[model samples]
Target: MTILLFGVTKDIIGSSTLSMPSSSEFGSKRSKTVKELKEYLGKMYPELKKLSSLAVAVNNSYANDDTIIDNFDEIALIPPVSGG
Candidate 1:
């Protein structure tokens, strides 16, 4: 699965996109949930946990922790944003 990064997320990740193992490729332990994905990312990118907030989008829609991610689904990481 490829996750699109935005704002600080992009800078922290050092890439606009990140590739993760698909469910079918690594089996059940690999995780198929958005929450799990977050935890996985936090582990890989420790800086992510320091962000003010983080949101996950699946197929262009904001996704919750329980959201299941398919192997071919479109994923994106939305970082905190503030403007005056």
Candidate 2:
């Protein structure tokens, strides 16, 4: 699955695209969800753990981690923004 990282989240992971394990089995398959992906990101980029209330979006629609995602899908975590 292709994860679309935005703002600080993108900086945490360094690169945009990521390929982490989704299952326990060896090279079983890829998994996409708010929770699963969180774990993946936490490992790939531990900096995310410090943030709170990360907004998960699927195909531009705001969604939860439970939402099923596809390979061509676009997922982004919208952290809070500040305006002066």
Candidate 3:
């Protein structure tokens, strides 16, 4: 399974693709929800706790915390996008 990070998350994670732990990968593994993934990331980088206001996407569409992630799904942790 792969988790993609975009925008500020990309900067924080230092990569686009995140590989899950061996134990978390298995048949039909859906190891995380948007909120869970955010908390896990905040644990890794405490600074991110201040930046929790995010728009998460699963398969290119905005996802709520209740959304489930399957191995085949594309997950992207993207912050709100703006341009001028």
Candidate 4:
């Protein structure tokens, strides 16, 4: 799976995009839902857990934690924005 990162997320992850193996093998660590994705990322990059808020979008639409995900889905991480 591929995830697009924006704003602070991009900074934290040190890249604009991230890739994960698209496999559903018994021992594969692929995320199956939005919530799992968050947990997976948080574990890999603990700094992500420090953010005040984080949002996820699937195929350009905001998705909830229960939202199902697959390797073919387009995912994005949106970080909080502060403005004057």
Candidate that scores best on lDDT: 4
lDDT of 1 by residue, 25-54 (tens): 333654478888888788888999999889
Kindly provide the TM-score of model 1 when superposed on the true structure, using C-alpha atoms: 0.87
TM-score per prediction, in order, is 0.87, 0.71, 0.73, 0.89
Please report, in order, the local distance difference test score of every candidate based on alpha carbons. Answer: 0.85, 0.68, 0.72, 0.88
lDDT of 2 by residue, 1-84 (tens): 566777877787777655544443222355546677677667766788888767888889998778866556777777667689
> Which tens-of-lDDT digit does each residue in 4-84 have in candidate 3?
877787787788778766464232244657777666767776756767477778898999988877667877777766799
- Once superposed on the true structure, which residue ranges of model 1 sit more than 4 Å away at CA? 23-31
Cα lDDT of candidate 2 equals 0.68
Q: What overall lDDT, based on C-alpha atoms, would model 3 receive against the true structure?
A: 0.72
Query: In candidate 4, what are the lDDT values of residues 1-84, reduced to their tens digit?
Result: 889999999999899999887552311554478888898899889999999999999999999999988888899999999999
* Candidates ranked, most accurate by TM-score first: 4, 1, 3, 2
* RMSD over all Cα atoms, model 4: 2.7
Off by over 4 Å in 4: 23-31
lDDT of 1 at 52: 85
Candidate 2 versus the native: TM-score? 0.71
